[model samples]
Target: MRAVILPGKKEVQVVDRPKPVPGDGQVLVRMRASAICRSDMSLYYGGKPLVGGEAAKTGTIIPGHEPAGDVVEIGPGVRGLQPGDRVAVYLAIGCGHCTYCLSGYLSLCSQWKCVGFDVDGGDADYMVVPAQNCLKLPDPMSYETGALLLDNMGTQYHAQKTLGVSGNDTLAIFGLGPMGSAGVLIAKARGARVIAVDVLDSRLEMAKELGADVVINSTKEDAVEVLRELTHGEGVDKAIDSSGNPAAQNAALDSVRKMGSVALIGETSATTINPSEQMIRKLLKVYGIWIHPIWMFEEIANFVIDHNIPVDRYITHRFNIEQAAEAFRLFDERVTDKAVFVWD
Candidate 1:
């Protein structure tokens, strides 16, 4: 089997490795579509991974957390899933008995392991994952869309759902990267008036195509002021930051009307916030979102199907597994919006 590994500093190589056999309660997923993510950038740079612990520090682990494929083999005790079933692989592996895992918030478990970072992932022809982590894909869904559902799309859905976004809401999304782009799709499906903001014209343009009612180029205009004007001075009803940029994060907090909600979905280590003005004074409700719960995959997938979301629209590039180097490089340099490794 051929798999991608990052030796260090944005270096990717395809190396041969023995095929893995599923263990108890696990299934062997034949790679079909595995999406590369911004989080994977850490692995590309040899930095700490978004998930997992010391294990990910090794930088030898396969680097793909958003993957979907067909089950080719089921291990002993794996009853619900069988060979030939189409499923999306949930990235987190947690102890089944933990409170978080029992409640399906596997990523919140103290000892949770990320499939691609902590262990082997779908950068190869076959990857082993817990059968319990497999979510059945609708017959109408493509493998690429299935890959998005678990991570990018699912995270945005969870954030908005938590914020209770709906038809009455004017949703402002900052950072039109893949995550923010997914936010636009989910908000539109929920019937919200979508105001998409980004520093890039390319992303803002993509947002308009995805049904955003308004697109604001933050680099060209004061996003906060423009959002207020668009909402008729009341400000947006819901705001989300998917950029992880400090400025964008602040804009999300500042652009929401008093009592309006905001969800921060991007990963950021440090950012300044004016709680007294941007939060407390506005009586805001803010949330930090990283990943969605395991059980929500089915619901999110159904939403994607029911809304006829153009999930494939987010994909700007696709490469075979052997092209991992160029794929990661282009993605890192922001030349590609959403790139995937597809297998025939």
Candidate 2:
């Protein structure tokens, strides 16, 4: 197998590697499509708590998590899934017995381990993951779109769940990145009036197509004031921060109404953010969102399949597995919203 490994800061290379055999309760999936995520860049550039730190150090890591593929082989003790099944693999393999998993918040499980981040991911010809973490793809969905259903879209769904946004609420998403764009679609689907914010005009235009009622170019306008005026002096009912930037986080806090919820879904490495003023003045419900639970992936996939969510619109670029380095470069430049590495 050929895999791209990020050995150290700003280092990535493709090399031949041995194929992995699935252990008990695991399934070996022949890679089909895997999408690069913002968090992947963080790890590649030395983010804290690197999931696959050891593998990365040894120069053998394969970084990818938003993977969709077909099961090529099943290991001992695996059941209910078999070879040839098309599946969207869940990256976070949480310990099932943990208190967090038992309470249905598996993303918060203390012993959670992730693929692409914690182990060798799907950026190669094949990858191994636990059978329990795989979600069967609908027959009609393309593998490229299916790969995103579990990870990217699922994150948006979870953020909405946290903020309790509904048909009657007005929401503002402070980023037009892929996940935030998905939130706009979901929010509109649920009948909320969505305001999307981004510095990029192209992304703001994309957000409008995805159903955002208004798009703010934050580089030119005060996003908070814009939201306040749009909401008639009361801020939006909910605001979501998906830019993973401190400024965006602050904008989200400043754009929501008193007592309104703010959900942070993007991965941020910023050590300090002074939210005390906003927290005290607004009595806000601030949630730090992580990756979503597996069950949400099923529900989100159903929504996408049933309602035909325009998830494919987020894919601005596609590359073969050999183009992994270029994919990461584009991601680094923020020139593309989402890029997928195609294998089959």
Best by TM-score: 1
TM-score of each: 0.98, 0.93
Candidate 2: segments with Cα more than 4 A from true spot: 47-53, 56-58, 271-276
Cα lDDT tens digits, model 1, 207-272, are: 998899999998799999999898889999999999899999998898899999999988888999
TM for candidate 2 is 0.93
Q: Which stretches of candidate 1 lie over 4 Å from their true place?
A: none
Highest lDDT scorer: 1
- In candidate 1, what residue range of length 10 has the lowest lDDT sum? 46-55
Give the per-residue lDDT of model 2 (tens digit) for 190-242: 77889999999989998988788899999899889989999999999999988
> What local lDDT score does residue 43 receive in model 1, on the 0 to 100 scale?
82
